[model samples]
Target: MRILLDSFVSFFRNNYMQLAAALAYYGMFALLPFLLLTALLLGKSITSSQEALEGLHRLTYQMVPEFQAVIFNELISLSRLSDTWGWVGIVSCLSCIFPLVVTIRNVFLTVFSAQRKRPVMIEILRDFSTTIFLIVLLIFLVISQIIYDELIIRFFMAISFPLYIVDFMVNLTISTVGMTVFYYAFIPVKVGLKHICVGAVLTSVLWAVINPTLVFLLKLNPKFGIAFGSLKTVFLIFMWVYFSFCVIVFGAEFIAQWDRRKEWGILSTKHGKNGVKETSPPLERDPPSLTP
Candidate 1:
């Protein structure tokens, strides 16, 4: 109990949320182009280009149902356009996503502030490696969405159950595993799987909740659209990214600090602070030099 309280205090004291906000801001820049590139890549491979486009469309709405109209409009525009920009957009998206990946790496490093330091070049290489990992994971996620989850869920839909439950379960598992891998791989410092698990579990819960919670909020208050106007979906996405990273940073902080809470006398009642429990202070030595 004491440890948990101190962890929250230390969490805010370090300004982890602000770092997440920056990651969110940069992540938003990467998301649109990355999604477009997925559609472009898949379209070229499949027998039906139209089928690829539809797959991207279905995936987007399943992730964020409240903004289906917006996603559809943009996807339609992407499909109707020539291939010239589609190729260029892929390159541009990679550039944006690289920096976002760099930021994510920084977030993990920042959380484990007291861990042993790596050489600058090694750290840079680690960041680049993790960035590649991130890109590959995303490609897999998009492909899986198109090929597996959507198909299986649709096959089951005839049996009865809202589409949202299927969507939630599929996404929940994927997001959790991704987060666990990200923390374990990207954090430059040596850390145990147990520590990584703690953060990953926390992040997965929050990430899973954000989408459905946003839908419920918008439904309860249709006025959110009025406030944001044409940018409603965009704003919501940005907020979603911000909160997602915030949760991730928080979990990392927990693992980093959990062992040190004892130093602050916050790990147990044996420290005898604030009447939580009473225990004797450490034994003290008597002075001998003064009498001599």
Candidate 2:
């Protein structure tokens, strides 16, 4: 119990500042994209004249009574915007790269806080490349999803049960892959693909368990309710950004601990004097004179 308490204290002491900075940085980048995406999605409903969109909006309003007006107004505005600006919007989205660099550097430093020096450019480059790859992979996954929706939906409708299972497995597999990619990309530690796979699976399970609870709590926050009324979803968006940072930090620590345990044996036994029983230091018999 003492060890557990110590660990928790250590985590907060070591990570709180970096976590806060990273969250703030990422939150700023996330806000525009998040709002734009929400708008586009809602606009799609209007374009298709889908009653389901209204139902979803209503449900969201009910769940987050405080933010209903804000969310609704944003969605309405986004729907009105011309699609031609999407390319320009995407180009501007690159602004996220700067803060992402800072956040990634901080995450790397946090993971290797025991190291003597800060990460160098080469180290940063490697992490950046891997992150880019992961982003590309995620894009591919999105494209795959689009294809499924466009071409496979009709075929799958005929065998919905089997298709449902396949889709679930595919999503799980992709999520695990994405997590593993991120673990290797961001953490400065060496982890095998197999270990990453294991960590990813564990992360997925944890996320599945925690996500719904988090959503429920976020909806319950009265401040979010107020912000939604004012056409500003900033508070809720910031909360999610911070929540994401916490999850990433927790996942990194979990994977690091797992790797350390495997490599160095149980954490409890990894740091004692080499096979020797611990004892109090011998008392000096006499005070020694200082000599050059």
Candidate 3:
């Protein structure tokens, strides 16, 4: 309980909400480009562009059902735009995702309190590497989902198993694993898999709750977005992104706080301070102090 409370307090004290809001803003700008890049890369594989689009659409729907159509339509538009721009468009799309990745990396460093000591060139290369890694990971997950849906899902249905249970479990496992990788990759601190897995599980569970709660709220109040007029969709999408970042930031904080518990006497501290002494006095100190 004390650890949880400290994490919560540290979350706000560290200005995590502001960090989340910043991520949401960058994410909005990067969304279309990231999707376009994904489709373009997947086009080189066995998957047809249309199939890729469908897979991306399904992923988006599962993530934010309320705003999936808006996102999908934009992805379609970007695909058309890419046809004329050629390599330049692809390069631009690739570049656009960097800012978001960099923001995420910085956010992780901040949450974990990892210092930035690497050279600028190294940092840029790392950012680029992380971007490509994440993009590839996204494509991999999408393709895997496509295969799983066609194969595993069919088999389950043929066996008369409950589809919802299968879906929920599959999604939960995927979410947890993906988040675990994300937390490990982004955090500048060298964290153990156990700590990250715990944080990832927490994040995945909270993230799973988000979509259903949003869907239920929208269903219960279909006109809830009307107050925003024409920008209702945009507003909702931004809020969804913001909420996601909040969960991510909180998970990172949880991991940091959990690591702190390993320090000797940390749990016994009343104010959550490190109770271990930096340097202990010698057990047999000379009496030279009295002579002096």
Please report, in order, the local distance difference test score of every candidate based on alpha carbons: 0.64, 0.52, 0.76
Using TM-score as the measure, the top candidate is 3
- Model 1: weakest 10-residue lDDT segment is 283-292
Better of 2 and 3 by TM-score: 3
The C-alpha local distance difference test score for the whole of candidate 1 amounts to 0.64
Worst 10 residues of 3 by lDDT: 283-292
lDDT for position 61 in model 2: 39
TM-score of 1: 0.71
Q: Model 2: per-residue lDDT, tens digit, 3-121?
A: 22333444465544456456556655644444444435434455354443444354333223445566666655766564654766644544454356446555644543423154678
Preferred candidate (TM-score higher): 1 or 3? 3
Q: Which pairs clash in the backbone of model 3? A: none
lDDT of 3 by residue, 208-280 (tens): 8987898888889888878899998888888888888888888988887777555424445533455543432
Q: Give Cα distance to truth, residue 69, candidate 2, Å.
A: 13
Better of 1 and 2 by lDDT: 1
Clashes of each: 0, 4, 0
